[model samples]
Target: MNKANPIRIQRYLSGVDYPQTRDGLVRAAEHNGADAPTLEALRGLPDRMYEGPSGVSAEIGGDS
Candidate 1:
């Protein structure tokens, strides 16, 4: 949570679409158990960060 980056907060709330309502963003953070900083990083992830059916495939396959 780089308290300096408001954009990160905005992105985390709205998703890639548009600025989400404040409440929506708050709920999302709560549901995901994400700290403000972690949520900010997730929001900053590149669009292609996850590819494939569930996005977990890459992580799962990494152990093989």
Candidate 2:
């Protein structure tokens, strides 16, 4: 997996609502256009519910 564009990560997760689990978020990100690296980053995050894109980003090492 290649490195991902941090800014686009949020846009890809647009369809997902808050309180989504890491697995669910990863699926949504895939459905919305996230690449392999982005998916990998999401997968690497701690297993928990995310409140929003920022939460996902923060866990994936973004400047949220």
Candidate 3:
């Protein structure tokens, strides 16, 4: 599968409250209309609270 773009992921994650968990991020991304690959990337995130977008990007190994 193609890797999801971190910048695009962040766009879908805009307005998400900080310190969000992986599940929360998934929900937020879904609400923002993230595509299948984006959701898959989000689902692959470590199950923990994310302090910010950078944390998410770091987890996914992509530059935002």
Candidate 4:
């Protein structure tokens, strides 16, 4: 998947907890009412524990 807009991705992931895995973030984003694009972008994230929003954003190749 290509890089998504960091700001938009973060918006949907606003309620996420730190140190969450990609699957966890997906669930959080779904619960937070993320749209298809946002969800798709999140699903594209690496399958690893993200320390924080910054880490997620960085992995997506965008500045938070």
Candidate 5:
């Protein structure tokens, strides 16, 4: 699940810039058609800078 999740998350972050804050990632994901689970996970993320999906994946318990 972890392995596949990042791949799915990537689809929503393809055009987003790196080093995004939690809010930025959520907004970006929403703009790119992220689903409820994705948005919920983003909302639960820590308030900090993130380089890419890997960091977000880790927060959601992915093996990043």
Candidate 6:
């Protein structure tokens, strides 16, 4: 899914600043209904996708 999509892994964890640790991201992803393994996979994605120059990018950017 697109990184900036509110329902995607990035947006779901963006509120917590892209989580410096896996556990943090997992918790955030759970709130968005992501399964544990899915959350772990998403957490391993590029940090740039989750953290923006500001907050979550207003634009979703290009495809992941």
TM-score of each: 0.30, 0.77, 0.89, 0.86, 0.77, 0.39
Q: Would you list the rank order by TM-score, best first?
A: 3, 4, 5, 2, 6, 1
Extract clashing residue pairs from model 3.
none
Worst 10 residues of 2 by lDDT: 55-64
**Local accuracy of candidate 5 as per-residue lDDT tens digits, 1-64:** 2123656777887788888998998899899999987777777777999987678777767543
lDDT of each prediction vs. the true structure? 0.40, 0.76, 0.89, 0.85, 0.77, 0.50
Can you write out model 4's per-residue Cα lDDT over 1-64, one digit (the tens) per residue?
A: 7668888888888877798999999998898888888889888877889999889888887553
Better of 3 and 6 by lDDT: 3
lDDT of 6: 0.50
TM-score of 3: 0.89
For model 2, residues 1-64, the per-residue Cα lDDT tens digits are 3345656777778878788998998899899888777788777778888887777665665453
Best by TM-score: 3
Ranking by lDDT: 3, 4, 5, 2, 6, 1
Q: Which stretches of candidate 1 lie over 4 Å from their true place?
A: 1-30, 52-64
Candidate 5 TM-score over all chains jointly: 0.77
**Lowest-scoring 10 consecutive residues by lDDT in candidate 6?**
53-62
lDDT of 2: 0.76
Tens-digit per-residue lDDT, 1-64, candidate 3 = 2467888899999999998999999999999999999999999887999999999988786543
Which 10 consecutive positions of candidate 4 have the poorest summed lDDT? 55-64
Candidate 2, after superposition: displacement of residue 6 in Å?
3.3
As for lDDT, the candidate ahead, 2 or 4, is 4
Cα-based lDDT at residue 22, candidate 3: 97
Per-model root-mean-square deviation over C-alphas: 10.7, 2.6, 2.2, 2.0, 3.1, 5.6
